[model samples]
Target: MNSKKVRILVAKPGLDGHDRGARVVARALRDAGFEVIYTGLHQTPEQIAETALQEDVDAVGLSILSGAHMTLVPRVKKLLRDNGMGDVLMVVGGIIPEDDGRELINNGHADQVFTPGEPLDNITDYIGSKIRS
Candidate 1:
């Protein structure tokens, strides 16, 4: 059995100063036995992608509530792909609209779009299933 912990980078991108949810999620993920890197507030997409590469994480969780997901998710996704990290699991959580979430997934911008009220187990279980560590 592989004992390597699933590494995840939790990033807060853009000028959205609200990070309570991101922190909460990060903590829960840590408790769930994943190695999580929390990049504190106000991060650019470039920085996020760079960190993802540097950390060699298995997944990235983008927590955005600034209403800039439409612009940010794509930019980050592009950067990840550009850097040859395209297969890295990409997940976004925030106040995204239902249609927008579907569009993000449909458009291949994100592997999953999670909105408010999703149980922590859902996130943890989904990641555990998708990624074998």
Candidate 2:
């Protein structure tokens, strides 16, 4: 096992029932040697933040495809910060537009945003780089 195992919480937030992408990302992260905890589906920001706190994860990765990224990401970030877990890196992936992605990052909601079809290695490398630093 890798000496530096980054604990990550991969969550599917909102009514987005399409979880194939989220599941694939979780598997890729696991294969990359990070310990991944996946929150099944239909999770709210509160639930995700609470899970991140309880799991002591180094990062929280949310997969949002319902065009609710704007509302959801900031809420998640705020909740985490309020719960004293502000250091936990937050990331979002899925059908997010470039403008919205930038907004989320600028608002300090997410560290990065991965759109659909981005390689798995990209996600793994990003997580590794963030956690290892």
State the TM-score for model 1.
Answer: 0.96
Per lDDT, the best of the predicted structures is: 1
Q: List the lowest-lDDT window of 10 residues for candidate 1.
A: 124-133
lDDT of 1 by residue, 3-78 (tens): 7778999999999988988999999999999999999999999999999999999999999998999999999999
lDDT of 1 at 40: 97
For every candidate, C-alpha RMSD to the true structure in Å: 1.2, 1.7
Task: Provide the lowest-lDDT 10-residue window in model 2.
Answer: 1-10
Tens-place lDDT per residue, model 2, 1-133, is 2476689999998899989999999999999989999999999889999999999999999999899989988999999999999988888999999999998999888999999879999999998998887
Q: Cα lDDT of all candidates, in order? A: 0.94, 0.92
lDDT (C-alpha) at residue 11 in model 2 = 98
Distance from true location, Cα of 7 in model 1, Å = 0.5
lDDT of 1: 0.94
